[model samples]
Target: MESVRTCVGCRARAPRAALVRVVAIDSQVVLDERGSMPGRGAWVHRTHECVDAAIRRRAFGRALRVSGSLDTQTLQNHFQRNG
Candidate 1:
């Protein structure tokens, strides 16, 4: 069976491997490609909209329980870097 995780933004459950694992680091969000980061985790779909929504809604901060906003450009940069 596929492992499942809940998206902190929409609170939707999906296959864990289908989600991108985001972690808060030094108040910035980093995409955990290996899914082995040791910190609070937030999950979002790999789609552009989902990622944009998550950043716009500060879903990572909500999931990581942080108190600041993360720039959406970072997520875009990540996708460019990873894609």
Candidate 2:
């Protein structure tokens, strides 16, 4: 069985291995491409829609429990990178 994680954007629980891990560093959202980051982590579906939702709703901030800015540039970069 796969581990399960909840998306801060869609708030849907899914297999951990099926989700993407995101971490917050200095109040900026960082994609944990390896899922081994050493800080609080948030999970989101590995889809553009999910990633956009998290950014649109500021769910990353809520999930990471930090109050600060989000680097949309990096998020867009990730989306573009995945394309």
Candidate 3:
């Protein structure tokens, strides 16, 4: 069965494949492109708007259950480059 995940940015529920998986490692938020990262994962829509919303509202940290801010440059670039 396909899994459902909620987007941290938009709070919309969707199929796992429709969103990008992110995880915190070494205080850095990285995209789990292959969805194989061994840690808690957060889901976000594959769009700049959704990513910006998540960053603007600091949802990544909360969704990932991390303290303090996370560097989302890499994440932004990843989406923007491919968006």
Candidate 4:
């Protein structure tokens, strides 16, 4: 069976395949397209609304258990290109 995860932005439960996995590396948020990154993972929908909410609520740091601001430019770029 497919795993379920919560979207940090909307706080809604969704199947793993319905959401995208994000991970932190070197204090930067990176998109895990393959969902095989080695680190704490946070899941969120690919919509700009969800991404915006996640950033607005500062959910990444909390979800990833990090203690400082994280760079989300890469995340934004992904959305921009794919959005």
Assess each prediction's global lDDT (C-alpha) against the native.
0.78, 0.83, 0.93, 0.95
By lDDT: ranked, best first: 4, 3, 2, 1
Q: What is the lDDT of residue 51 in candidate 4?
A: 93
Which residue runs of candidate 2 sit more than 4 Å off their true CA positions? Answer: none
Where model 3 places Cα greater than 4 Å from the true spot, the runs are: none
Per-residue C-alpha lDDT of model 2 across residues 1-83, encoded as one tens digit per residue = 77888987788999988888988887678889899999889998888888888889988878888888667578668777886
Kindly list the per-residue Cα lDDT of model 1 for residues 1-83, writing each as its tens digit.
88999876566899998788988787778878898999888888877667767767767777788886764567768776666
Worst 10 residues of 2 by lDDT: 69-78
Candidate 1 accuracy as lDDT: 0.78
Location of the lowest summed lDDT over 10 successive residues in candidate 1? 67-76
Superior by lDDT: candidate 2 or candidate 3: 3
Q: Give the TM-score of candidate 1.
A: 0.81
Sorted by TM-score, highest first, which candidate order results?
Answer: 4, 3, 2, 1
TM-score (all chains, Cα) for each model: 0.81, 0.87, 0.94, 0.96
Best-fitting candidate, measured by TM-score?
4
lDDT of 3 by residue, 38-81 (tens): 99999998999999999999999998999987999999998889
Per-residue lDDT for 1-83 in model 4, tens only?
Answer: 98899999999999999999999999999999999999999999999889989999999999999999999988988898899
